[model samples]
Target: MLGRLDHVALAVPDLDAACERYRSALGARLSPPKDLPDHGVRVVFVELENTRVELLEPLGTGSPIARFLEANPAGGMHHICYEVADLAAARDRLVGEGARILGDGEPKIGAAGKPVLFVNPKDFAGTLIELEEA
Candidate 1:
C-alpha cells in the first residue's frame, strides 16, 4: 500500500531559474542538479521539512518533460510521488482495481534509486501519480 508522500515534481522550462526562485524567493534549500539521462531530465530537489519538491527540466527534445513543457509552456506540476511498501503488490492491486499503469506496467528505477511506477492521470483525476517503493 501507499506510504507517505514522497515528492511533488514540477516541470520547469528553466531549471536554474526555478531553483533560484525557490532558493531566493522561498528561501528553500536545494540539492545540486542531477542529470538523469535515462529519465530524460535534469533535476534539483528543494529540501522541505515534510516533503521534497523536485524541479525537472527536459534533458532532450524527446523528453517527457519537454512534451509537458510544450503543452504548458510556463511549466507546472508534473506529478506527485508516494512511497509504497511493496511496489509489486501495490501495482497488482492497482491493476486489479482497473487502474491503468503507465509505461510497460513494470517498475523503473527512479531518482531516489527506488523502484517507481506511474499511474495514468485519468485514473486519479487529472493529476499524474507516481508510486515509489518505500
Candidate 2:
C-alpha cells in the first residue's frame, strides 16, 4: 500500500523558465536539473518543507511529457507520487483488485533512482498516480 507522499509532478514546456519562476517569484529552493533519458524527461525538484514538487520537461520529441505539453500547452499537473515499502507487492495487490498499472506493469528507475510504477488515470479518479518504492 501507499506510504508517504513522495512528490507532486508538473509537466512544463520549459524547465528553465519554470525553475526560474519557482525560485525568483515563489522564493522556492530548487534542485539541479537531472536528465532521465529512460523516463524521457529533464527533471528538477522544488524543495518544500513537507513535500517536493517535481518539474518535468520532455527530454525528447517523443517523450510522453511532450505529448502532455502538446495537449495542455501551458503545462499542468502531471502526477502525484506516493512511496511504497514493497513495490512488487503493492503492484500485485492493486492488480488483484483490478487496478490498471501503466507500462507493462513493471517498475522503472525513477527520479530518485528507486523503483517506480505508474497507475492508470482511469483507476484513480482520472488522476495519474505514481508509486515509488520506499
Tell me the whole-model lDDT of each prediction, alpha carbons only.
Answer: 0.94, 0.93
64-126: candidate 2 lDDT, tens digit per residue: 999999899999999999999999999999999999999889898887889999999999899
Best by TM-score: 1
TM-score of each: 0.97, 0.95
lDDT of 1 by residue, 1-134 (tens): 67899999999999999988988999999999999988899999998999999999999669999999889999999999999899999999999999999999999998778999999999999999999999
Positional deviation of 109 in candidate 2, in angstroms?
Answer: 2.0
Candidate 1: segments with Cα more than 4 A from true spot: none
lDDT of 2 at 37: 87
